[model samples]
Target: MLAAGRGYMEERETGKQEAVASVREIFGLSGPLYLTAVDWENSHHRRSVAASLVQGVYILERDRQQKRQGHQSHASPWWNFFHFQLISPLIDDVDFSIFGAIYEYNSSVFEHNAPKYVIAFRGTLNKPDSRLRDLKLDIQAIRSKLHQSSRFQLAMQAVQDLVAVVGTANIWLAGHSLGSAIALLSGKNMTKLNYPIETYLFNPPFFSLPIECISNPKVKHGIRIARSVVKAGIAVAVKGQHHSSQKDDSFFVLSDWVPYLFVNPADHICSEYIGYFEHRKKMKEVGATKIERLATQNSIGNMIFGVCVRDCEPLHLLPSAYLTINMSQTPDFKRAHGIHQWWDPSFDGQSELHLFR
Candidate 1:
């Protein structure tokens, strides 16, 4: 009986390996693959630019995975496809793994309507080697400690250095999932410093309940009002004590620098953003702007920490964004939250945009 059980377990493991191999081959994981075939020089709009930036991020993932499999140098076709060259890879010192990279467009080949440089960060990978550190950062993000992480600090410094060298007008930032959070935070920090850079965030996590999933509009509205009132109370309580003029100025300045936010309704991790922006519009319509504005800037967690320890802002709160929602149907959560969907030809046309302030 023991011998038979061992044989069955071994067979199952082998089957899983074969299945994984098949999937990888189909997706061209063994080699470089382009997600889109758009003409780079002829087309230079939001969709095209976003595709290039997201692809740069995808290459970062491929580069690291290839290295893990003992490949010394893995040439990425996606970077070449967009006529971009890998400049410097952002490394996580703790794990010595590549979490992000900077790509420079080939100026001689394409000069019109192209970003001079793009810095992209990859999301979490479920692989055995890097999962520990990646998840550690994810947890830190939830606790608002992501800014203090070595990886985020490295990303922020890279952005600052690049901006100093090339100026903020020509640089772009892109990331997916966890990477999106890093890019978003980095962009926010730079914006606060009076250097706003163009940013693309794909499926960035919103560390709140999926209130957007509520089917009834009235119930959802009621819940939002209740939550806002509670947060507003906290904001008022701490208003006189911890609120500083500099902090208010920072938030006001950030309101004018809007980043491009790409989200899918099926992706619960990011879908709350849809409701978040929509709720603000509704608040304006109903004359709750004063309460909403106060609530928007303060959260329970940040208020408590600000009074007790130090001032901290909610990571997910943003003053403005060019919110683009993927309206196309997705098969599952993974597909919905995937970075690949951002570049899909069908998806390019299926997205709807709303400018939120």
Candidate 2:
């Protein structure tokens, strides 16, 4: 009888341990290293401030994954760690899943220098359930049809509603990868309406050839100038077709709303932005400002497509941005494109910033 009682107690203890392990795995805490908390007060502009925003977007992914696994937790560990309360989740009508969230700041804990509300969007998740819709949106983004997508329309409406209520002074927009593209488009539209809100974009795709990979500087510069001349020619050819007044107004107006763009040089998906901004500066130095300005506003592919289909603009082109490049050597593309790296402590002093205007 004594031996049987001892065996039963041991089995119960083992079951409890297994249950704990299962929960940890569901919450993405199975690994040895976990996410660290940020110091909200001391978070410098580009360092900790950027990390917090990126982390907020990451938590949206976590929240969805946890619920998908039947954990059904009311609170997210990551959001709680950052002292943010989830106001409401942005759900996909078709999938009936959460893609983004609006978080309200804990004013008691963080008094000043913080956003009153942050709307964060998560990138594509490769899971079986969400893969189809997410990939469809990504393809639409590449084709410049993202604006017509249901998800983007939902996001735009959310931003507009929030701005209407809060007046856009303390509201912020943040996202990662595909989410970043959505945020970028939303910010651009808001700026066009003269409602400029703070935006943080992580690993935003540039949708161009990875020109930064070319080893020879002279070769790269020559190629860029050639492309610019060709694009400028196309712009002039179609100048009569396009509405000059609207195009010029939007181009100059967007310059006032600069979004914070964080990218990794090792990640090809977004590294083209580095070359785009650098080449513009070089053009100015070489006294090719006229050609560069025309090229920047229009793209040959977009122009031809717009003529055939409808009026459309290149999704990746930006009039201005505060671009930050992670110079740290990452092990792989997955890590380089990940949202976690934005919050890594090693990111400090390992980044370069350029104000592209």
Candidate 3:
């Protein structure tokens, strides 16, 4: 994908240039992809946001810290402090030089191969702990934390920049877990705005995205404007859950991804209720919504989401609503923990995917 050419992106004689081009090429098969990393910008357990211009795809990972877990100076001060950077090894898994360039691989991508000039965007605090992240459903303290969310906003800005830079005619996005949800939001938003940024979402949490916000006609109109080329594009979502998923399946959307992606091994809609239907039912019996909403505006929304957020209105409804999609399931092999990494040696970008939908 990478070649010695002085096109739109500033060309470099070094192999590093080839790598970024390769990433761009792979993701760009769909469009000039941009991946922004963040747990919606809530708390400390955030993974670093690293976006590789892999082929036509822009892979973004977020480095986040654990919620509720207190800190003196910082949680991961000694470490890289970014969950996104920790997954650096994945950079080797893809052929970023596929961007019409003669590509080469090396340590530079592992060390410091990011674009020389990065345009950083600001994060927002939309809601507090409305999206649930735990099984215990213990969000009493979390409610006091999350004040707002800045994940989508920050990602949107980064994506806009990437679009301007590569100016791809197509677009696609893919990610796992929370990253997956973010990708869908960004992709759907861009599409709605008429940006024509097609998307490829892998294992996104249906429970996290704000349906109301995404479906808002205003947001849709915004996306329709930036969209140049027009194709519903491909969509994919991967999912698997444990006993909690009574039906042993997930939901689906018409976007060309897995019908639904599972977050916990237990159930497909774990984040919908407070904790357990019985337990949350009891909480609702009291006054959980009022408390949760109050907490949402308390910690700037960031603090609440970093801890507990499933109690909020739209976030709590994510899993349930997504559970309603018509999905076509694919058989998948169960592997160990690091199986999700991009460079897991045997990681197959095309293989693990279920594109039939």
Scored against the true structure, residue 184 in model 2 reaches a CA lDDT of 90
> What overall lDDT, based on C-alpha atoms, would model 2 receive against the true structure?
0.69
- Tens-place lDDT per residue, model 1, 21-63, is 2222223452224434345354224454564455455445444
Error of 2 at 95 (Å): 1.3
Ranking by TM-score: 1, 2, 3
TM-score of each: 0.84, 0.83, 0.28
lDDT of every predicted structure (CA atoms) = 0.70, 0.69, 0.26
Which has the better TM-score: candidate 1, or candidate 3? 1
Global fold similarity of model 2 (TM-score):
0.83
Total clashing pairs in model 3: 102
Model 2: worst 10 consecutive residues (lDDT sum) = 1-10
Lowest summed lDDT across 10 adjacent residues in model 1 is found at 1-10
Give the alpha carbon lDDT tens digit for every residue of 104-183 in model 2: 87856655656888888777765555667888888888777888888988999999999999989888898878888889
Clashing pairs in 1: none
Please give, for residues 235-338, the per-residue lDDT of candidate 3 as tens digits: 01011111223232222122332222222222232322222222223334555533322222122232223332222323222222122111223132121111
